[model samples]
Target chain A: MPTIVVDVMPKPEILDPQGKAIAGALPRLGFTGFASVRQGRRFELTVDGEVTEDVLAQARKAAEELLSNPVIEDVVNVAVLTESAQNESQSA
Target chain B: MTAQNTELPLIGDYSTAGPVLTGARIGVVTFPGTLDDRDAARAVRLAGGEAVPLWHAEPDGAAALSSLDAVIIPGGFSYGDYLRAGAIARFAPLMDAIIAAAGGTAGNDAGLGGSAAGLPVLGICNGFQILTESHLLPGSMIKNESLKFLCQDQVLRVENNATAWTREFSAGEEITVPLKNQDGQYVADEKTLDRLEGEGLVTFRYVGGNPNGSRRDIAGITNAAGNVVGLMPHPEHAVEPGFGPDSAAGMRLGTDGLGIFTSVVASIAGGAQ
Candidate 1:
């Protein structure tokens, strides 16, 4: 199974008060490495069958039309994450 | 003051058309978790119009929608605000019917006739959000700037009187209505905002200032034909006195929102005549 991940984030010019609050509180908790933090929504969809280009195109359409609203947020990324790649990243 | 002419010439009897004027039947849709359908119905009735109930659960609502002169999508936390305030409600079956019936042009299955350009649809609060999600209207609503639920009597100015739901109001007239919601800040791209202003599609604007940080202080807007309207304030909540917001003169005389309902009814009646 291939995992289709869609990351939706507010436009760069828009305000992200929730993300700002989180970043402001992080330094107080002694986590000071990050310069900035912007929060966004992530959806991990597990699609059955082989991950083909057609499946990716369908996923992109869903992300563009339904999963993401162009008024305020931008669909930052829509990519397929396979199990082998997940395992490799986890092991490294 | 001089004596007034008690017998002003009454050209043609006003009562002659009494039998011909049937109350314009306005449909109010109710989705799961919707809170203001009853209020919207009452407002329609009080405005001398008939209120028809349309439910989202019933898939056959579109068939009956043809008889309606106009439709209203009231406010509430539909689908318990899941996946954002109105994202889920936008997919409701009745919403499909509304989108089809809107803009005076019948979609493939709308079954309605004639140009309903004068008055077609009005979406309030959560309904406004749903309209945006459905692409029936533009812009999107995010959380309040303060990240708090807002519940107050908001003042709005009539920015455009050409819209179906604002025909009864004068341009620049101020009206006070109840506005309560968690996610109400309206946002859109710069070009859209500019287009809205340039086209005079902005129906209502905040009188004092931006209440929920809506872009350009816009509280409500109409479509290109001025038939479909979407707004963040609860006009249905301020239709009656004593139970509504207080007036600026320290009185419980807040019926400013009634104009929206009456405006639709009047336009429908005028079109019929």
Candidate 2:
């Protein structure tokens, strides 16, 4: 089996209410450090077989169909890697 | 022990304690600025639903499991309130799982299919901010018309009172609750606002006055299906009658907040699936 991964996010243009809220609250908490907090989802999948983009696509399709709202949230970036490759990137 | 499940003792049975929330599995997602996760969980238990806490970074969304019946995105600052309120939270590991489970496969059912059917999702304050950012709700919350951080006990008129979360509220009934946010103003295009008003999509409205200058004095709104609800007021803060906001009539109201959680129980048990 191949591993499947899915990432979710609001279309870039769609304004993030939660992000704005935290942005507004940070100064009050005296912990304003970062510039922005763009909220989105990241999904990781691992299968028994090769983790091909095609397999990942299936998961993406499932996410688009059921998981994400294209009108407001959009899928931006995606990448597929073997367990070793994923580990390499993580270690690096 | 939840009010549902029927496993909990009805009247009194000291020897055999009941489940915490019975079997009403409820989920609470924590974003970076989320400050009310614990309060939300306690409110769920008071209303008889098991609270499942979800995190922004924790992967393996599989933990949501089939046992869950509803989910609550508690209020707080997620991701240090960087760009927008709920913007960063929308990308949390748990959101992907929720989106997949509830969004469902394209052809299956418009609503969440499979085990997520009748899954009631509620967003409060920052949670409400997340719902809009996540596209779970329409319209948006902007800077207060006054551009000031607003915190007050406000009165609101329950508008539709027909959602999975607001079923317990009487339509048009006025209730007081806390409103705290810098950007609580709700706005939308004329058409969308008109449709929302005409379609009875407005859930609750600011009672005495518009706290943050929301469109049409709107405090909350629900989806067409009524399973998903987003609001600016902190219903979770006013569960017990006396402990909650002052009831309209001035009685020793402890927890009106239970109604929100109880509404979830009603939605799952008596939803139009």
Strongest candidate by lDDT: 1
Which lDDT tens digits does candidate 2 get at residues B11-68?
A: 1111132466456777787665678887787788778776766656654664654557
After superposing candidate 2 on the true structure, give the runs of residues whose Cα lies further than 4 Å from its correct spot: A1-92, B1-21, B62-65, B104-118, B248-254, B271-273
Can you list each candidate's DockQ?
0.49, 0.05
Total backbone collisions for each predicted model = 0, 60
Measured with C-alpha atoms, the lDDT of residue B233 in candidate 2 is 84
Say what the RMSD of model 1 is. Answer: 10.2
lDDT of 1 by residue, B54-155 (tens): 767656756767788898988988889887788888877677667776743334344533334433889999999998887778888988877778999899
DockQ of candidate 1 (2 decimals): 0.49
Best by DockQ: 1
lDDT of 1 at B76: 89
Summing lDDT over every window of 10 consecutive residues in candidate 1 chain B, give the lowest-scoring window: B8-17
lDDT, model 2, position B191: 83
